[model samples]
Target: MQDHISSLNIAPMHSPWIEFRPNRPDAQARVLCFPYAGGSAQVYHALARGMPENVELGAVQLPGRWDRRREPLLTRLSDA
Candidate 1:
């Protein structure tokens, strides 16, 4: 299996939140993946289950979508 997938560090203007499924601890390495624009970390919910035995999958859930649907959507990519 690959050594890693993807990871990102987001410092939001306000509070940020993260979520994940149950995970087991082992000698395997952990990988965090980020989704593309309009994408959400929930998409990777299965990653923790379908990932290789030696790899851990984690996803990033950015605000402004599903959870923040009430929030205004940004049009310009840079504005997001």
Candidate 2:
């Protein structure tokens, strides 16, 4: 699992918000996945693998979790 994750070419758009796992610049579509409360981007790893090559899978890295643990969580929808 570590090897697979490390091999991905991550392209983070606004680092705090979205992360494309193995970015596909010419993908025909994109899917943004959000984790359950208190969950992290890792939740979408398996899903990303199943995605078609023409579709990009992006995971939302909410604040206060995982690598963003140091950041404060969003209290309002507008802040997100």
Candidate 3:
């Protein structure tokens, strides 16, 4: 079953999922963000302001919120 799906362009997402906005490939550094409970990746949308040009940012959306709501919630902090 999995093999059949792999034949297509579809691919599974890896963990600590990041948003798919246009990325800054030349960035010297990257930021991995985690919002407070009940918050979504959108919280960091405005965080780019005033940051250095070499800095890039990525936000992690916890389960049960935003687009990932269909997924299960993190039952433990370490699991997040």
Candidate 4:
């Protein structure tokens, strides 16, 4: 079962994927991690150490509150 799915190209498809490349250059699989809304990227800093030797850990950094302080947040409600 695993072999069949592995045949397809399943690279990181998540938006703003945090790439945590392993020290080894010949790694096989990479882990794509995501955070919930209003979450910061720093939360996943220690994820690299918990992952397997062959698997690379990656966290996505979305631009909203923490990353972009200069940018103002928009709040609007649309009524039907």
Candidate 5:
């Protein structure tokens, strides 16, 4: 299990829109979360704290938030 977890990659990408918090790569399931309206991926940071060691958590960041300041806020629901 440790080996599998160690093999997981959590590097920040160039987009700066996706935030990943890998707790257990060996886990059978991964939990992916989407940020709320006008919110950034970091909004889920606290929620990841109580996740079991066997569960991996990933947060998705949208434009116009956090590091994506240059991006325009999504106005249409279809864009989400």
Candidate 6:
């Protein structure tokens, strides 16, 4: 999966923080999206698809969700 993402130029800002759906190296703007309560990075899939070509979409992947289900959940903003 990592190889596939790399091929499409989807690079994570910080592997544990932001997951770019389809990173655009030459994008004119970047939008970082956060999921709702109990949601995961996938929640932004549709938004990513609807964004303009020049706008890059990055989905924030909070710990304790999705692949990070085993990790401890952050209880405070300061913990992030």
Put down candidate 2 lDDT per residue, 1-80, tens digits, no spaces: 75664456544344567777767776656789988887998889888888888678889998888888898988998887
- lDDT value, candidate 6, whole model: 0.79
Best by TM-score: 6
lDDT of 2 at 2: 51
Q: Write the per-residue lDDT of candidate 4 for residues 1-80, one digit (tens) a residue.
A: 76764565535443332545443333456666666766755676687777766566676665454665455443542310
Q: Which stretch of 10 consecutive residues in model 3 shows the poorest summed lDDT?
A: 5-14
**Candidate 3 residue runs with Cα over 4 Å from true position:** 1-16, 20-22
Could you give the candidate ranking by TM-score, starting with the highest? 6, 2, 3, 5, 4, 1
Off by over 4 Å in 6: 1-12
Worst 10 residues of 6 by lDDT: 3-12
Residue-by-residue lDDT tens digits, candidate 5, 25-73:
4654467788766677887888787788766677888878788778898
Candidate 1 per-residue lDDT over residues 5-76, each given as its tens digit? 323322222233444443534424556677788887778887677876655566666667667667776677
Global lDDT of each candidate:
0.58, 0.78, 0.67, 0.55, 0.70, 0.79
Per-residue lDDT tens digits of candidate 3, residues 27-71? 555667878878998888888554566566778878888888898
Q: How many backbone clashes does every candidate have?
A: 0, 0, 0, 1, 0, 0
Better of 4 and 6 by TM-score: 6
Q: Distance from true position, residue 36, model 6, in Å?
A: 1.0
- Poorest stretch of ten by lDDT in candidate 5: 9-18
How should the candidates be ordered by lDDT, best one leading?
6, 2, 5, 3, 1, 4
Preferred candidate (TM-score higher): 1 or 3: 3
Cα-based TM-score, every candidate: 0.50, 0.73, 0.65, 0.51, 0.60, 0.74
lDDT for each residue of candidate 6 in 1-80, tens digit (9 for 90 to 100):
74553356443354678887777766566788889888999988888888888678888888999988898999999976
Model with the higher lDDT, candidate 1 or 5: 5
List runs of model 2 lying over 4 Å from the truth: 1-15
Q: What is the lDDT of candidate 4?
A: 0.55
